[model samples]
Target: MSNNPMNMMFAWMKIASSYNQMMLSSSEVIVRRTMMMASGTMTLPDAMSMMMEKGTIYATATERAAVAMASGADPAKITAAALKPYSTKTQSNVRKLRG
Candidate 1:
């Protein structure tokens, strides 16, 4: 039942649809949980802490992916390669942002 390119596309589409639904459900959960905190004995600091926890989880996951991608390079080599054009481009971006 898996002998065609069209079938592969359909399979991937099904996976993507499920993934999107999961993301929507997760956002709905955050909205619901935060709503109760907004009216309860929770302080602003507590809400911020929850938000920060979610942000850090995503940040660390992204960092881990980047590390995995860079795993083939030695640390010093990777640092030098990244810095070669990145530093100048970052400065250019900062100037563009300021303007």
Candidate 2:
């Protein structure tokens, strides 16, 4: 209801800040869950690789969600975008695996 452009800007900034906080908390939860899910069968290097890949996926989702929300996009769309990066097909490994 605020007609002042500055007020609207501040309001959006608040929303962005809140989104960032939530994203960070969610990312922590994600990392914790990933660690918990790693069984004793995995090697140290393999576990670290899995953790790093999952963390990157989590981070990318949050970053995209923040950008979408800051751009005045629909919140539902933002949430969906955050969930989008979870698919394994979206991930890429920079390190080449030589058998």
| Local accuracy by lDDT, each model | 0.51, 0.59
Clashing pairs in 2: none
lDDT, candidate 1, 1-99, per-residue tens: 244677666655664655555455555555655665776955677568656755555555456546645676433333334333323333443343334
Expressed as tens digits, the lDDT of each residue in 1-99 for candidate 2 is 245677666656765665665566556545554554674444678568756876788789889899989988665557656765653222222112211
Q: Which stretches of candidate 1 lie over 4 Å from their true place?
A: 1-18, 41-46, 71-99
Clashes of each: 0, 0
Compute each candidate's TM-score over C-alphas: 0.39, 0.43
After superposition, the stretches of candidate 2 with alpha carbons farther than 4 Å from their true spots are: 1-44, 88-99
lDDT, residue 12, model 2: 62
Quote model 2's TM-score.
Answer: 0.43
Error of 2 at 27 (Å): 19
